[model samples]
Target: MIAAGLGCRKGTSAETLLSALAAACAEANISRESVSVLATGEIKRHEPGMIELAERLHLPLHILDEAALKQVETRTRTVSKHSLAQTATPSLSEAAALAAAGEASELIVARLIADGATCALARSKDHS
Candidate 1:
């Protein structure tokens, strides 16, 4: 992952956001069956279909405080098979953080998805 791969505005819709995440994951060659997702705000605060969509994807959901997300790192170990160009975005780290933190809104996530990205569900490693 690079830095800030996940970039979004503030307050996007749920469907769009999920699509971006899915695209990011696909780009990374990561299977949805293998990763968990972190969401900001309370369960009730999310969109109506979010929970159900997550469940269908078989992704575990972890809730985080948006402020807590600012401290997290998005970049993971680099893949030898990939170069900077292959990544979904210029900043894999930021993208990873957004995927994990949901700092940006659904609309932003959707845009990235439309632009072609593989988004994944991530949680902060800081959690036990």
Candidate 2:
């Protein structure tokens, strides 16, 4: 599962938080459906973009209160603070490997994560 939390920053914008989520998902080989993304802070503020991302990627996103998110975020690494698309795309198998030992599931998650980021950026830009 890919997990993301907006660390050390209060009132961080949804775009910024989503960027971190996208980055972690890229590295972990997780997708919207295969993984559950729990975002810290207010979902209402992020509803438009989050919903759009979920629909495009077919992912289920849960926006939790900060305190609750923190409880589960203790051990996970956030890695890149920015989006992962600017980096080179991984091969199908390579991307899958990051997800799990299972070949088929990994590839699906990787592709969805990558595609979800694209949908997010596009949707956000349109709002801007």
Candidate 3:
């Protein structure tokens, strides 16, 4: 399974998110169609843009709590000061991708920066 973890500022728009996803997908050398799920922090569950993007893509959205993100934060590559201060994680996108993809997941792409958003991709070793 492949997952795309997303982190965005408040009031981010779905178009901006789609652009970010495209950049991240490009970085990972995979089409957006390859992504199986969308993941984000639980705190962002209420973000309308995030919700809209997921719905638009017809993919499952997995919201991970702080504890869940923390469990895999250490495995992430990029260290965003904002992410650490706001979410206590080195990288929300990276951690979210790893955590939601499954315990045995590995990051396929590190943080891909975009306007008011960030994304990372992960693949499950067991394909579960």
Among these predictions, the greatest TM-score belongs to 3
Candidate 2, residue 125: Cα displacement in angstroms equals 36
- Model 3 lDDT per residue over 77-116, tens place: 9999999888999999999999989999999999998999
Query: In terms of TM-score, how similar is model 2 to the real structure?
Result: 0.35
Overall lDDT per candidate, in order of appearance:
0.40, 0.33, 0.92
Backbone collision count in every prediction?
Answer: 28, 0, 0
Q: Which stretches of candidate 3 lie over 4 Å from their true place?
A: none
Score residue 5 of candidate 1 by CA lDDT: 32
Best by lDDT: 3
Is 1 or 3 the stronger prediction by TM-score? 3
Error of 2 at 80 (Å): 11
Q: Candidate 2's residue-wise lDDT over 1-128, tens digit each?
A: 33232221324444644564566565555553434433323433354655554455555444444334233222222222322222122221122122222112222222223323321110111111
- Candidate 2 to native Cα RMSD, angstroms: 12.9
Off by over 4 Å in 1: 1-18, 41-44, 73-111, 115-128
Give the total clashing residue pairs for model 2: 0
